[model samples]
Target: MNKAQEKPIALSIRNLVKTYGKVAAIDNVSLDIASGEFLSLLGPSGSGKSTILMAIAGFVTPDSGEILLNGQKIDALSPEKRQFGVVFQGYALFPHMSVRGNIAYPLKLRGIKGAELDAQVERTIDLVHLSALADRMPRQLSGGQQQRVALARALVFDPSVVLLDEPLSALDKKLRAELQFELRSLHQRLGTTFVNVTHDQEEAMTMSDRIVILRDGAVQQIGAPDSLYNRPSTRFVADFLGRANFLEGAVSSVNGTELKIDVKGIAVRHAKGKDAAAQGEKTLLALRPERIAVVSPDQAKTSLNRIDGSVQTSAFVGSQYVYVIDTPLGTIESQMPAFEAGPLRQPGAQVAVTWSPEAGVLVKDK
Candidate 1:
């Protein structure tokens, strides 16, 4: 079992349901967040990611279901009583107060004063590497610095959990990437159960120990980043987590653990693991672009699956070259590492795409 599974449950949502007017914003969703695990609620806008986060923070009351903390239900508790630190998307830093004051506010609210509050504020500030900027106001600090202040404030009280709602969404790409690493490191050092909400797939995959994917106010899938990315249970997951090329076909033959799918008369070999499709059953294969290799038609075909196609379009994307290949089945997208992609394949160039049977994962059509 993974470390997360070994840890005790810090929070649990049992059959959580929340509705807005006639729409169910969070539809019968349930999840267990292990102590010290960094779990991200990931999905597009209006997918209920934020709604679930708000519910956990006690900001939004659910119509049904229970929110538990350390095995005890806290559904009736107010936001502050739950002792779950929250970092809003806007940072919500106190413009009138200095960083030290902002960090000390939570402690002050609890009647903590004097050396105790000062020490806690100082320790939390240093924890987020903001000791030097303790006296700076929110307006005087950079976006990243302001975010650190917000985090320090949330953590000062030593809350049972920290809830982040797209905390890094306001920063630029480079700064955001830098903070993502820092935030992950902070989580490791503190071992605090962090429940984050985000729409950015890369951000979710980068910082999460495990991710809960939601869609249309309901849970879609929940698993470790690599597990969900490599062996997605559905087409939605396969496409949402990363770029995926789908091949629709019917199983033509089954040989022990291996199965062959007939895609427009082309035999696409697939490995049937636990969830196997029966022979003649319609199947959908989610193939990652990076798994496909574009080679000359005369190149030796050692892989189980190969298809002849012409490069429809090609573009250099920093570390990799992305190509759109037009094949009999459909337009297949392939991403080849710049180091391995010897020369750019021009449009209309004939090529053969190859991938191993193990590379294609069978996913539900839905």
Candidate 2:
């Protein structure tokens, strides 16, 4: 959560490549996961996120490259020797094993017994706050509780790193959200290195200190949640991480960090980063719906990024109104907070979608 750069490198992957015959599962990946940091590998199915995690856990052998722990290569090590705690989606708790038996399984495998094993099991159950359900079987526990048991089982042996493969994906939405909060709190409390793989964007963003976006077996962008969300490097990332309104335009002018681009004959200002170049290349800009405001046509003021559009459709989604507006450029989605006093921005209504220059981010089309 803090300056992870100064911390020791817990895991490092250099030029990692793996292929299943003709298909490439992981392609030329390099990453450094800092000690005591929570990093999420987020992507759709078959994006190589799982393959990378498997390689780190020594479950899958990569076709090339190296995996280092504390700067020591461990590619030839087996899964058991890696000592990484892994929690799968199924919770994988033995049906016959009680909560206590499940959490004590790993320790028992190592020949620990008697008072020491009992104390370790008890301590881990308390860590996950599963004391009340320690005697319950997997069939009797709720999905969340079963997940907690799986976590306790994973942490009982105190591995150097923990790998979670969508552990909360089996639970209900409410339960999932609750466990997400719990996971975040637990990570902070334990300060253990966690590598999570999930297809859910909000889940990754909610619990991860940093997120690595993978696309078709390669890394697209890696950064903090806010950086990846607000300043996505590519079009796929912007579209995947969140809802985005992409506007393609030709570069009109560049003034240091200020950029002016022409989009469908409508000029929009863009705020550029330090590496922004004036290569006269056409660029795409991503605008988040939440950053856009719906203004009544009569009260709309001329701004740097104000467009008159008709609301094609609008849905009242609890706290906000999500509208699909059609303009000359294309279909744009805008989200506005629900107000108690005003009329809703309904369908076929004329409105102005206004946003600041800072709201538009330049992203790579590829």
What lDDT does each candidate get? Answer: 0.93, 0.90
Reference-based lDDT, residue 339, model 1: 90
Error of 2 at 121 (Å): 0.7
Candidate 1: how large is its RMSD?
1.0
What are the per-model numbers of colliding residue pairs? Answer: 0, 0
Top candidate by TM-score:
1
| Candidate 1 residue lDDT tens string, 1-366 | 667979999999999999989888999998999999999999989999999999999999999999999999999999989998999999999899999999999998999999998889889988998888888889999999999999988899998899999999999999999999999999999999999999999999999999999999999999999999998999999999999999999999998889999999999988887657888999999999999989888883676688999999999999999999999989999999989779999999999999988888989988
TM-score for each candidate, following the candidate numbering: 0.98, 0.96
Instruction: Give the residue spans of candidate 1 off by over 4 A.
Output: none
Candidates' RMSD to native: 1.0, 1.6
Residue pairs with backbone atoms closer than 3 Å in model 1 (clashes): none
lDDT of 1 at 96: 98
Badly placed stretches (over 4 Å) of model 2 are 273-279
